[model samples]
Target: MQVSYIVALLALLAVTATAQPFLPGTGFLPLGNLRTTDNGGPYNISLLTVQANEIKGGLAAKQNFTDKDIVHFLTNVECLEGLFDTWGTFGHGFNNNLTLGGPTPIGARKANLSDAVRPFMEEVALNEQGHALFTRQAGSDLPCPPIDFTGGFNKYFGAAYNLTGNDTIESKFGAPFDPFLNDECYLLSVLSLEELGATGNKGLTALLTNPVIANGVAGLATSATAQATVQRMLLWERRNNTVYPFNETVQQVFARISALRDSLDGPQMDDQGLVNTDPRTIAVPDYYVNMIPTDVRGLTFSRTPQQLINILTLGSPDGVGVFFPKGLYGAINKPTGFNVSASGLDSFPSSGAKVASQLSTQQIGTLPGPMLPPNVTGELDLTQSLTGTLDNGTAATRGYTIIPPGMPYFSNASQVAVAYPLQTGSSNASSNGSYAYGGRRFF
Candidate 1:
């Protein structure tokens, strides 16, 4: 029975996955419906994956070791198994739609395809999953290192690589031009290349031959001034400096997006006005051309080889993990407590540089775009709280590290909401101190 449900759910996902886009090249391939808070509720994967039989069987099956062996579940399935693309960047390079360059209003805000898919895929994006996977596997082994977090405070924009002379990747995001890597822009940009297949070594070459780019391509401007237009778009993106748009729109930007908001969410238009002007499909504007440049002299689209969207999204390279030698901050997934290596640092900088270059590559990368109410965590029903003072007489907080009960990490922005409570009076104060273990980070 449990197996039946899993099979059924997979079928449903497969079916719905084939739904026609409201517009052309509008569905799948680009970001899917995973990330929208409102839209994703009905299709919540948690609800979908839950099977009565499985849960019952998980605990019984793995009586010795299982989150619930009734059904004997495998808690630590490798993220590699979930890899859809050769490079594993959202499994891009397949027959997916190019993120449409238009507003898709859903409720209070207008979202692009990328914005819409975020809520659904957020957890499984592999970026967070990497940490979770590592932590889940961590045990007696010299203790796991903390997550590498680059303290992104969002201030001061348009600066050099590093004021410290090391060209360290300063949060790379700031004000004025919002949607820093936090937005779905990267997803939007990436989905277009989904059909490149598992080993898309020649995917870019195929894209070039599609007739949407330089010399002759769809959505690419056939006009004589097309080259200048592409150049202008590139310059605009550089000026904006937001590769992954995170912040919402400004007055003017909002107005542009506003026109389509009502129509997108409220009514279903038969006409999905996504302009498929990619050089592979048709003549496009300099916007598309410069944004997704295919015309490298003497090079075919397949030769350029579009990197997997995941690579573009989360930064690339399979083995060379990011280096935090100088003690990084709390934003960019900083591998906590790990001794940084120079070779590791040197090797992956190239991949990081590629992602960096790709991000601010075109004007449109600048665009678009959290949470829930929680669950069970209580020490005891009684008034007495679990408190033990340190030998130095310094009282410790109720929960250790404020890392949240189920979670391993603490205080990172994404997980900041899970706060560790402070018991004021004394370690054994009244033997009764109860506070919300992990709620939204208020302070």
Candidate 2:
């Protein structure tokens, strides 16, 4: 009887080992025998089975724009390409000099860059190259227009500082304000381009019709914002450091450059510097670390294509200016006298005080820029430096304590990880190219 029972148990185990689970539509075969072909196999879900009417319907779903709208979009793309290409050229020149010993001397003058700063410069140059390539791929067919990096800086810097002659830097400060001359100058030049790229792409986002194209532009804007933020942080760290031959602190130079941009980009206060005396709007104390420049709602500022051209052309009525001697390669290269009215719109309150009264105290703050120190004419002291140690014995960190305006601050990675736990269970294909759950299959 015992021998007969053992034989029956052995037969039951063999049957169980060879058995396969039943699927809803597919008959049972091997344990994991679900397979699919290029034509979607047993499921019969082939693109060839789709009707011509379906294809037409899919194509018709796309939004169509007028010729004028197309031209506007294309022109914005071209402007972005131009900006990226120019910055890439600047970065490439600086990086190439590094290969030949170090940053090449501009005439007899030279600037020193630390190991920490050099890597960031190299990365920014490469990033600009990527940005230009992507912009060209997106529809910017125009070649880079004539750029005046050398004479352009001399001309624009002179206008900004109220200096006379083309050799403004040489006459007023003994050395030219050449970006390639030093790390500070290079960073400042890059900052200007980056800010424009960010604002330009952001302004165009709402006008884009295609989701894929709009997403691409939004990505470019985000990257430009990140690049600008890093550059600003680096400059703010060296706010007290002096620019060569100018006898002005880095912060002072930033203020002047920002002022130049604001002056040329119409009456709108769209530009800002490293520091400001504005009272803190958010819950933090009256700390003045102007790293991320934003509007009252903590939103990034946007610039119309025309306003961007104004700054690029140094407010040239004929369009041609310092950066692009022959003007930008697009229809929107010239400013159209489209200035935002200083008064609030008819639909909104005219007085800023009225607007402030409506909003909570946590949301009130002045505009960025005009970062001149209160009543100080000489170089800014260490007290103004973002990275400088405070007299109260607290260490100044890189980014703000409260980021993105209202979100609670996460002090470290552990806090973030705890707040947003990692999800378990991944979707992966089996060894036989079938899904783990065995419903879908791939060739």
Candidate 3:
């Protein structure tokens, strides 16, 4: 049958179903006619098919969304592409400069700590690249606009580090601050990026319609959250081993970065361009919810395309910023809500037998100086970070006592293994794909 016929059949079946929440006016957002003709083109159809299968395997999961809502969603995808690209670029630069089994740079690698930082940085780069690719595949019209990673870093870092105008990465750490040099500094910066992505994906996932696409997007968001949590765990571990150079706690630093973003971005707006008086505190529906914990409870913390635009474009109404390009911003309707499968929402799967042990302590050695006191306990309770309860109990949160050995969700092989532990039977080397693990592998 033709694709249109299939879509028509699906629509007909959907309409015939009783009490389905999909509204009467719902339609597919036009993927063509984007703000710019710069998009490479539609993503690989095979990949889409794989994504569709993944979604189906993940189980069936839609909304009164209009063409404008679709536009808003696409626009958000474009912005995410740019943001993740910028972060990936920064991660590469950081990994290279750190001399972590990569190219050399102007300054010395901080404390010769290649092993600790390089792998994590490289993983982050790949994960970010995957995110950007998925965003494009999902339905992005515009190309990733140019972003000044250095300038954006300086702005955020300056706020968090209390650095003066003259003080820069080179001035403070013997290298430019944009890509970062200090190990802790890189950790903190990446931490913030991962957290932003994690939360943003949660909100965006709720807005999706296709179950396959929704599952793919939710996988991206879950990886981001897992990465962020790992960063926090590592930072805490470092702090505990000795009096590290940085004085602030992980929570304090993350809060400072968020505050800087809010202060610079101004008032948050919803999909319909309505002013959000309390953007940080606003609630989102249980669509594509994140199973991991966050600061808020009772409501999923959400950021609409407009809010993302505000922060990424640095409050530019026209989507133009010194660091971000104007074309990156697409018109969005005022903020709205959508419905998704409450039971089948995105969640991090538990660990596997290969590395079932909870993240334990290790001596990371001392830094150059003892700027702060050691945290021998290393027992900073991130339980609060992982717990939130909704008012209506539509969604519940799961907290972890320690970081897992591997990233979670369906975005990766290890994650797939963990997500569908029942599929962990013996296999031949040639049979590499996780067909048992919900058919997540696209190829």
Candidate 4:
């Protein structure tokens, strides 16, 4: 019976895959009618190799695991996987449409993009399936939530740009939110999603207590993080490789996008037609982008699972409820703890040059975005920004030191969250508590 249902779902997905090109203000018919909030809902996977029959029972049934931790992990994984599959499909469809090499059904002109971009999307699409398989094999039973592509895009871009149509209000740069209609928009979207995927994967790995399962989960996270770095490098190279009207660097572009919220002073859209001609400042707020470029200095940020879910689901109740509907997220039980750090004061390169430029020409390099922080060796200090206490008096400090490969050294101090009552700091003055963990710092 399960086999039959899987077959039927795949067939439906295949049929819907042929739907017309995506247009702003339009909604694509979702495949399964299963409510995202349901417990026994259908898993959104169809590669045949990952048929639902192979899935183990829910992770909460796993041996030697606490019920609360398992439930929380499963809930978060379900939401993350749904978003991954949806993002992959969105990317796949966009790339497939670009291959049409003509005017699309939505009136966007299509041209042959660089060879690098297409294969990247293809790999990302397939990689998402691997993530789905990983979650299922780990005994996650959460249902796959449908992705509202149009709504999701609007929620993201409308907040960032104050316009959502295809070259309607302004014709200078084409559609502000339509990736299919604009190549720059497509690349930017790719960079953003890939980076978010990497962060989400890494953050989730820390909470996986089972060593056996943690190995696989960590591998997936590393892969996602590597892909994100590659996307960042590519974005930088693509911009430098070509001359455009706004021949700006990646940092400049990021700055412009970050400035979009000055009009709103928050992370929601105003929609009052107060946009300016700078092409970056919007009348609304982009909580996601705004959160990305924090004003804090010398430290990088990674969202806890709940924080990320809020961004992915468009602040909740407005989109799929993968993490909501009682999946298990409370103030005390965050999906994962914060753990970020750097080697020492000398760990950051002295010149503040981009990470890519410091590497040997033969060595692979990553951009110095918040996703990958500077990792060097010297006297280290946790920045004031990453440390604090929550409104409820819970210690807010959590992070891992970012360091280069083979260095494997992070002698720094952090203030552990107060919820862990057993924890005692080595000192009360400048040092709190210092610990070391094993892993190659990809930064």
Candidate 5:
């Protein structure tokens, strides 16, 4: 009986082994063997290869965007486009005049830009132009707003330093903080703009939904970040060099500018200087250089559209401040009451107090009288034609039409209430603690 049982068990094992080969869904089928029937016909092989347009269309359809969503997306895109346009124009203007034109209002002699730094500045300008082009293609049609590179810089810088008349800037720094005056000034200006651009782009990534559009924005953010990094590296190299006429070093100026920007953009300490000033924070070899501005997690800081507007406007809660005198041409152009001061006029010098008061009373979208010359020219024309080849070897003409004007501007009071519902309280404690540097945490 035992012999019979053993033979039966062996037979069962052999049957199971043989059946395993034919088990359901157990083996891979050859590609040739796989077939599909649709409408009583064989599947078309051409459908296997998906096209770029089809994917984009599918993603857009899936999003099912509403009017509000479209408006928000366009606003963000137009803001970015305007920023690139301004930067590109500034770069071109700088390149056109390599030397400091004349002494500042204070009669301080300016230094010359070295040949070595010219190429880098040119590259930044070209990259900005490319960025503008890409954003234009992506769907921004707002014309370039009036930019006040000369007077704007002076007014903002004066506000930062609390300088009122000719003597303050000239007596102290031997200059009036003119960006086009020297290499140091040019670099400082570039650093300020690029860092803001990088942070703004980083903020936009979270709001974008369409994968294609998000990918394009991601590319822009990456480029802006790289530009900012290059500027910081350059500034770090010149950290110890004395800013002409001033008793302060280049790094000290960097810190002051950073502090000013931080103050303008609400109470957050999102900006950073070239050097690490905190003694409690620990690093190997006492890390003093801060090449990248980041938070506790080593992540780059981001700013909302409102915060960015505040900085551009020199802390003006309303639009029509420095950089963009006429204000941006999109829905996100208006500022919320999240600047250095609730009124946005406290930072202005005595000379600008009247203008600030006038601007404060003006309604949103009301174009202020051109206080400064529209020195920065060149608009993003939609009729501009781009020639390219399609994937299937066919010629294609990629053209864009002007996006219609943004939705009517929101009321200033409504914008303020909606944007910043809760007023942030002041905190004197430093946000940058030793815990950020991987040091011992008291909590």
Candidate 6:
């Protein structure tokens, strides 16, 4: 079927054969000798399509799963992919620059962007049998990992939101944003892939629809470059630029919405061509493949890193601050939705995370200067930036204040660095990728 399992296989670093055939064992993991048992469980996937349609009589399996067979079955169940990649970042609000978010240098462009490409572009814009398995494999390369699945974004300034100093883009979310990166959701995913390549529509009505491939996703989503590949694929395509390059029918509606969103290998469906959902009847993970590496260098990538520290350190080498001094932009907060509040996980760098806990968690450990001193965010620094104006005028001096626009979380963690947003047993800053801790050990 898979060409007698790829003509009895031979490459892919060669496991030789027995890539199938292991049997007996489920919860503890094993039943694999290539069928006749263990679909991992939950009605063992209708005896795996009734034993692959009694070994191909009724058909279906000329080719099925791939992201290279879930990265070779999670590298043959050895583990260590950790859902998303770049191995979790760490560059908090202040005290940064040791290389900031690591893993580039060898020639940049690999800055991270695989939170499953925005829930596989919101299940190809909300499902319909995931748009017919996103039109039966629309393009290919497959495997849509996003790895984990946190979602929660767009707090305004875009990506992770930032206002640095002289901040512009029409002062964010109000309009303007074309210093490049194009906005409006990258121009509504590039005019919706330029209207699906001037009207091919992936063969009609997009992604084939099955609620967009059972929400794991596999179609639509295309920007297919013409210009700005975010500064030319982050300097020459190291790949992973917030994962857009999509195509093979939007990577099979994001591998069929990561195969109905369920992983750790129960109903696994990544590598695009998904059908998942069985991590004990699904808790979540059919469409989140954000690996985030859209080409990085000295920092300033956006998609949220405190909006690149509010547009390059409060609008820096010198755009000026004290509330945009002339860049002017204010009022939108709507409880964090106008975006750019430092980079979102609530502004990072705060190890303990517990300060009675709540000013909407920008965490706030050392800010004062990156621009927040207009009455310390006393709710109205429309950003004209004389330094946003301070003394106690506050554009963000750090004692933790800003809670006015629509206030919701983070009044604590001690204004930015005190305890537990997952510092858990306590320890942090092993360099970037979120709280890595000095000695670092989240493997």
Cα shift from native, residue 133, model 5 (Å): 0.8
- What is the C-alpha lDDT profile of model 4 across 219-334, one tens digit per residue? 76677666655555555454433213234443344333333322211121111111111111111122111222211221122323433444454344332432233333322123
For each candidate in turn, give its C-alpha RMSD to the true structure in angstroms: 28.8, 20.7, 22.9, 25.8, 24.4, 26.9
Candidate lDDT values, in order:
0.22, 0.48, 0.38, 0.33, 0.46, 0.21
Top lDDT hit: 2
Q: Could you tell me how far off, in angstroms, the CA of residue 54 lies in candidate 5 after the best superposition?
A: 34
lDDT of 6 by residue, 1-443 (tens): 88754643333113212222222221111111111112222112222221221122111110122323322221100111111111112112112221112122111112233343433323322232232233224332222211111111121222213333455434543553221131222322222222222112211122122443323221222221121222122212222223222222222322222222111111211111111111111111222212221111111111111111122112232322321222211111011211211222223323211111112112323223323223322111111112112221111211112223212211110111111223333334334323432222221
Pick by lDDT: 1 or 6, better one: 1
Write the number of the candidate with greater lDDT, choosing between 3 and 5. Answer: 5
- Model 1 Cα lDDT, one tens digit per residue, 1-443: 99976875565455344432223322212111112112122112222211211122222221222112100111111111122111223433112211112111111112232434444343323332332233234221121121111121111111111123333323333323222143333232222222111112222112222232212212112221232233223323332333433342221122122122212111111111122111111122322222332221111122111122222112222311221112211122221111111122123322221211111112212122211223212201101111222221111111111122222211111111111233356332233332222222111
Ranking by lDDT: 2, 5, 3, 4, 1, 6
State TM-scores per candidate.
0.19, 0.55, 0.43, 0.40, 0.52, 0.17
Taking the tens digit of each residue's C-alpha lDDT, what string does model 2 give over 1-443? Answer: 99976875565345333332213343212221111111221111121111211122112211233223433433443333334333434433322221113122122222345677877765765666566555556665555455566666667666667675444778878877766566677677678667888886776565466777788778878988998999999998888777776777777777777777766654334566676432211112233567777632245766655566677777776677676666665455565443422212113232211110111112212212342124322111101112212211111121212234312221110100011111233344345322322232221
Off by over 4 Å in 6: 1-17, 20-176, 179-443
lDDT for position 66 in model 4: 51
Model 5 error, position 80 (Å): 9.7
User: TM-score: which candidate is best?
Assistant: 2
Whichever of 2 and 5 has more lDDT, that candidate is: 2
Local distance difference test, candidate 2: 0.48
**Candidate 5 residue lDDT tens string, 1-443:** 99976875565455334321233332211111011122111111222111111122222222333323333433433333334333433432222221114111221222356776766766776676566555556665544455566666666666556566564566667656666566777677778777777776665565566677777766767887887788788877777776654556677677667767767654334566676442111110123456776542245666555566777777666667666666666555554433212222122222211111111111212222442224221111101111221221100100011112221111110100011112223232124311111121210
Higher-lDDT candidate among 1 and 5? 5
